[model samples]
Target: MTDRIQEFFRQRRAEGRDLGPCLVVDLDVIRDNYGAFAKALPDTRVFYAVKANPQPAVLDLLARLGSCFDTASVVEIQQVLATGCTPDRVSFGNTIKKERDIARAYELGIRLFAVDSEAEVEKIARAAPGSKVFCRILCDGAGAEWPLSRKFGCVPELAVGVLEHAHRLGLVAYGISFHVGSQQRNPRMWDGALKSSAAIFRDLAERGIHLSMVNLGGGFPTKYLRDVPAVKAYGQSIFRSLRKHFGNRIPETIIEPGRGMVGNAGVIEAEVVLISKKSADDQVKWVYLDIGKFNGLAETMDEMIRYPIRTAVDGDEMEPCVIAGPTCDSVDVLYEKQPYLLPVSLEIGAKVLIEGTGAYTTTYSAVEFNGFPPLETHVI
Candidate 1:
């Protein structure tokens, strides 16, 4: 956490206004993260994934930094455009889209689209004729914290047919794309996907359709309870894999970073609601916070992402505790399977700081769940 955020909480407490869980995002951190990504992949373009965090201030900052956008919906596209970014800099990255949305995006000057099936290609060709379309292939999401497999991409062979159908239907078969997974910690994971992409490139070239680009989909991770590699490490590994797989002719490339772009730039401050035990003989105490899965900590689902939580009594004696949220839902518990270690002196009304939460919290927050308002956000 930054000093500015600490001061914000201090002032709020001084005014007796630190009443609810809120997220504070530091724009300076985002600016530095953008510069790091740009430097790491100098030859490749950076497309900020709007689904990660679509705050207006975040969008405006990235736009001014000369970053393109990967939007999942028309509303996200509009949010990016509201920052004065041209439609040419935005890609409709979602494969499963309504034909009407494709038409709408085309009307809005979006010429780049993602596809995984011939049906999708046909829709795009009919809606946005001659637009650039890239086919996504499936990758076994090995070594990723939150694996993104099975739902989005087609097989490599199917991708070829989809792109070929797009070519026949008057669409520009642009290139190949694959996501290694989200929060992938292994830098070497890009090698296998790049190898598949190279094979697709060669197969299409033999059929007289030469591709020009490869969308190296985002898997870059942000620091959490466990440390992750630096962006430069991923960049070097990816560059080396590109040379090994597609020698002499590295196609024009781009990266879509969501978590790595903004996950570390934000922090959440939550108040301890209650501290209790289930039974008289129970050794573990249940510590409930004002924030929960429905509010701002949805990433804790399946215990995949364990955020680093800090409190004023962190330096005191510690013990394992069952952490939960202040909700009536039975599944609101965050650390039941793997209990979190916290100070034994932690009590009700204590304020805790959750770090590395800049990307997904605000966007995932629910509105009026349990009569609790959405996660309030302040961009500094």
Candidate 2:
């Protein structure tokens, strides 16, 4: 760890007081990140994915930073609009199926949406006739960590048929969109997404159809205690491939990055309530902590797993300790292995301030079975 981080941790611990398990969003960090990302794409426009964090402050910051939004639901759209962003600047990027949702977005003057199937197109045609739309094409299943080929997005082979359906319905099929899944380490992964989009656009052009926009869906990760692809480098790299395939004369290039935007801006502060030692063997000891799979680090498809932890908010020095969460279930664990601070000792009332929780930390915990109230969040 850097000396500055260590000093920050030490200073906070010395001045530490009492606060409940709360989440803190460093708005300054968010603005700084926004500025950096914005300066990188000097010519192109950006659409921040609202699904990532959706803090109104974050949305307002994004608008002020000169980025639009990629909203999934009417609630998200309304949230963005409430931030004073025009619907034209916002794209309802998720696949629209329900008539009520579609009708609401159209009623609110939302123009562009993602179409994955004929059924969705038919629904949109009936619900919001003439509303401009984008067809989401399937990514070639090569480099995505979570390849969306099987579940959502239209298959490349079926692009013509879908576009033809849109034309037949007299709908303004305005563009195409594709997601290369999340935390994409390989910029080359976008090569497939770019190729698929260009191929479909060309085929559609052959059929005398033209599109005006292209939404490259968001998954850019914020470098929170780790470095992968810097957004600037990734954006430039993606743009190069994009220009190569579609040339300079193409539709508006839109990228929706969610986690890449606000993930580094927040951390969750939790009070340690209990500590217990589990003995798998004499040499194997697991230290249980107060936080668990619920309040933080809960985004697991099936089982809860802790990511490699870094510096805590308050660490005088480094020590080896295992962290676990406070829940009735045995799965309420923060780390199963590795070294966290032991604080020279363990006490019940001590705290753990976890970083990189800006995405899905608070109300992100959705469970009614345990009868737990939602987490309280405060921004700083």
Candidate 3:
């Protein structure tokens, strides 16, 4: 956890404020992150991904920074609009959108959209005529913490056909986009994706269609339990890849960042509901918390993602414990497969602050499941 986070929790505890399962966002950190990315990629346009942490405060701040928005739904588009952002600054980034949602986005003045298949291209053509569309080409999602595979993005050939169909159907074939996946760690992975994009641009040029934009969908990494390279490193690698692939013919570049921008800016404060030892001989203690998978930490599925947790319990000795949620569901277990150690003196009513939770927590939480209220977010 960052020093600011530790200090924030310390001050909250000093003030005796209720921190019950609340997701706290530090807007100043978010602003610094945005500024860092903007400085690193001076030539690239940033459209903050709305699906990460769509807190109105986040959107409002980015809007004031002159950042565009990458919205995945009509509600997200409306949220960006409510921040007084111009329609052209919002890109309907979801490739698989409902027809009515497309119409509504168009009605609200969203001109840029993302599409992956010919059918979706046709849907956009019919629903939002003359709209500019970008085709999402498939990537292997290598070196990414969250592999967004099989659900979105099409093969390059399919994407080419989709762009062709979009042009034939009277919609503007504006650009090509691809996601390297969420929490992408290896910056070299951009090489192949950019090469494929270059090939598509050449193919489109052969067909007398000159695409003028390239949307590098979000895969930027954030500091979690593991360390990642600095944002400047990612920018340097991307610029090198663009030069290697497109040379001087590079199109207008855009990056859609979700977790990379907000993951470290937030933390979740939860209370220990109970501690149980299955039997007298049981070595692993079950530490139950008020927040769990169904509540706001579903990213722990299969133990792929781990959040750094801190506790107020003070001691020199620590012991490995099994952390589980308060839910009765068997799958609510958080760290049974992985080692999670807390102070040996930790007990019920102790507050545990989970870091690197800003982006995925509130957005992915279930609403009022298991008689517990949904995760509440507090932006500072």
Point to the candidate with the largest lDDT.
Answer: 1
Task: Quote the lDDT for 268 in model 3.
Answer: 88
Q: What is candidate 2's CA lDDT for residue 68?
A: 88
Q: What order do candidates take by lDDT, descending?
A: 1, 3, 2
Estimate, for each residue in 5-74, the C-alpha lDDT of model 1 and write its tens digit: 8888888889988889989999999999999999999999999999999999999999999999999999
The parts of candidate 1 lying over 4 Å away from their true place are none
When 1 and 3 are scored with lDDT, the better candidate is 1
Q: Where does candidate 1 clash, by residue pair?
A: none
List the global CA lDDT of all models.
Answer: 0.93, 0.69, 0.89
Q: In lDDT terms, how accurate is model 1?
A: 0.93
Model 2: per-residue Cα lDDT over 156-250, one tens digit each: 86866787798889798788888887656566677777777888888888889986777777666655444677777777877788888899775
| Model 2 worst lDDT run, 10 consecutive residues | 302-311
lDDT, candidate 2, residue 219?
60
Each prediction's TM-score against the native?
0.99, 0.86, 0.96
* Ten-residue region with minimum lDDT total, candidate 3: 1-10
lDDT of 3 by residue, 20-64 (tens): 688888988889999999998999999999999999999999999
